[model samples]
Target: MDDDGLFTIGALARRTGLTVKTIRFYSDTGIVPSTDRSPAGYRLYDINALARLDLVRTLRDLGLELAVIRQVLDREISVPEVAAAHADALEVQIRTLRLRRAVLRAVAKRGSTPREMNLMHKLAKLSDEERRRLVSDFIDDAFGGLEANPEFVAMMRSAMPDLPDDPEPEQVDAWVELAELTQDPDFRAAVRRMAEYQASERAQGDTTGLHHDLTEAVRDRVGHALASGIAPDAAEAVPIVNDLTARYARTFNRTDDEDLRDWLLTRLEIANDPRAERYWHLLAVINAWPAPPSLAPVFAWLTEALRAGTSSRPTTV
Candidate 1:
């Protein structure tokens, strides 16, 4: 300290733990202007200048630009305001970094080709609203102007892929697959056919909504039959098939006869597309929802059993 209670640039460097060149640069920029000069014209700083240099260094460490830090030092903006703005910016950066990490991890896990990696990165980087729009477009294409079951359509619209900021690699993979599935022409045509079938049924005065109970009944009965190692064509499946057909008969106001069995088989064949099951599975994974039981196996069992017991060939819609 000089007799004037000021510190030379070298003294300020030692006190503030900053290199002499850095302190001299700040002094030259007038960010922490030299308060005085010694007899030999050395840059001298007082207590306030030392305080300003410390604040500048701290802000710089926090990724603040020199321009913003200068405004903070000049009192053009308050520190809290700058901090809040920077924090919001940092949040966007953090989300972007997390997404990148997820894409890279997914690429590594999948051993993806360059083309696949590029697609994954593009799809994963979509904004939340953009992601929702992609699904919404698919639903519209599949069900637009068709009297599809309202409940099922509602469920489809509601269960959109919501990739989180810090997504797991599985979630990333699911999202990428989902995006591709929604865009697949064959898958889209199949879903549209399902919608048309539903619309046709609706037009025929079949005003039934989604038959959750009927579905659960099939899954339960067929799941039990599957667990017992009973083949769909085995005699043991006859009673199980009869029970499920009776349930469906009551649910859809039809008689439990050969006709009902044939109709039920047609419905199962239409709904049992493996891609359809995969669509839901991916949605469950991306949204962190409990995986719905694999209805594919259950539906397959019932379809084969119906075919075994009834004189009906698989109908293509």
Candidate 2:
């Protein structure tokens, strides 16, 4: 090559596409040491320094730290090992960014205020422990004071709203809404009341309480009442009210009576909140359980009937 059998620093820089300052810096740092110098004291390199500089540039681009790159260039570790470790780190970073992006989307969709957005960001940024705690609180509120039906308790605890580490768009949306619903005090109270009924009769071993599954009957009949705008106490509501009353009476191993109808109506009124129905539906999704029957229209009909008319009233006393 040259008279001294080495390329000049400028020549090495051109081959490496590196600035003279950078190549000089690497030389000073001992990463790509010059083989020898010309009599003019200019730095000199054969092919080896050029190759070392290329490896340095590649490793830097792959996010390797200077120390790591040094070890790599010194042959202290294999490239595959470094690449694998960096890949795992990148995976975690990518997942975190994806979750943050989803959080932004949810915020935009809801048009969340500043504080709400902050809270949302906090929730989305939760560690596994924090996320588990949120759901556990909801479960605790729903099941507190309830009889420890082993199956029920197990299902509640194990029924995590487990958004996958790499959650889909819909799952992220579900999780955000779920978090909001559970945070409502009214929703918490409603679920608590529902749990009270389950724990009480079931604990007392009243197997026949929901025996008739008046769910379908209520949904079908009361849904019609709601759709027709029949008030809960309207004469038009008589047939539907009587239907649920008759169904409830049958569960008690007793014949129907005016007093029985009144009692059933009272209980239904206590148990039939719209939000409670929604809470249960959401819980089904979070727990991946089969959906229980809906009762909103059942309550809606009862509410309207109570308000409308009483021509065929089932006497309360």
Strongest candidate by TM-score: 1
Write model 1 residue lDDT over 157-198, tens digit each, in one string.
Answer: 988899999999999999999999999999999999999999
Task: Give the clashing residue pairs of candidate 2, or none.
Answer: 231-304, 231-305, 232-304, 232-305, 232-306, 233-305, 233-306, 233-309, 234-309
Using all chains and alpha carbons, the TM-scores for the candidates as numbered come to: 0.92, 0.78
lDDT of each: 0.89, 0.71
Give the local distance difference test score of model 1: 0.89
User: How far out, in Å, is residue 317 in model 1?
Assistant: 27
lDDT of 2 by residue, 1-317 (tens): 58756888888877878899988888899888989877888888987777888999998888888888888888898899899999999888988998888778877877879987787677766777777799899888788767734465576687667655665544566666778888888888776776787676576554553334667777777777677777675666677766566565666533535565455555666567776566557656544568887766566666556445442433331
Task: Please identify model 1 stretches exceeding 4 Å from their true place.
Answer: 256-259, 309-317
Tell me the spans in candidate 2 whose CA falls farther than 4 Å from its real position.
1-5, 148-155, 164-174, 208-213, 226-231, 251-259, 280-295, 306-317
